[model samples]
Target: MKRMLLMGIALLCISCQGIAQEKKEEKKQFPITKTDAEWKAELTNMQYYVLRRAGTERAFSSELLENKDKGTYVCAACETPLFKSKHKFRSGTGWPSFDREIKGNVAFDVDYNIGYARTEEHCATCGGHLGHVFDDGPKKTTGKRHCINGAALKFVPENE
Candidate 1:
């Protein structure tokens, strides 16, 4: 009886571990899936680094930082519409900051790559990493700051 009880408990523990591992390995499917080689061919060095590899660009190095034209920022990898110029605000965070994103165009996930939890943003259609969102934003707006990497985006003027 004791042997049977011990074996049952061990089996339960093993099954529970499998369940947790399965959940962890389950990845979200993006509509714009591509092979890594294809992505490398399509994106520039910085764009691949920031969007595909979840890397950050140097602060204040993005030309989009000073762009004030009425335009839409689209994902560099998939050309998915992301942020609009109208929703953008200068958060002085050395990155292109926006008060909001085009609704349902962006997705969020938690990232602990920096040793702390951060609200990481991704292009909903392509699953390319844009940047992180924070609560410290314009009080008059959504109170959320979508701090995006300019390299991960391509600006399309309103006329286009």
Candidate 2:
């Protein structure tokens, strides 16, 4: 009888842990929130896919990857400045790579979509999906590559 009681207590403890784990995944609040329809109406199809749905664009398909002009990369969803022109680099990874974000404008979360944990980036203002940041970057700089989707961003020239 004592063993049975102990087993029940152990099971209760295990179940409580599961509940705690589930709570960790609760929807996070962002500074800006919008309805799905509102987002669809505002963003183009590619922007909607990469930002709203967390879908990835095909490699080498972004026009912004080759942009050499000085500008700020802003979130497509909320126009929040995310990266500076100076931080951008030629990672040759077929995506627009930045050594660092503008800070405070970007947020992060861990995603295991492909069965491996990856550091996912997001627009802090609207929680729009941006891309993933990897540790493999220029050794001379931050040594972090922010492989962002061009569809998730808008270029704002400095003079503008």
- RMSD over all Cα atoms, model 1: 3.7
Query: What TM-scores do the predictions have?
Result: 0.85, 0.86
Native-to-model Cα distance after best TM-score fit, residue 98 in candidate 1, in Å: 0.1
Tens-digit lDDT track of model 2 for 3-68? 999999999987675553463656989999999999999999999999999999999999999999
Best by TM-score: 2
Q: After aligning candidate 1 to the native by TM-score, how far in Å is the CA of 115 from where it should be? A: 1.3
**Can you tell me which runs of candidate 2 are displaced by over 4 Å?**
1-24
Q: Best by lDDT, which number?
A: 2
- Candidate lDDT scores, in order, read 0.93, 0.94
Model 1, span 1-160: residue lDDT tens: 9999999999998767555234344578999999899999999999999999999999899999999999999999988999999999989899999999999999999887887889999999989999999999999989999999999999999999
Model 2 lDDT at residue 156: 99
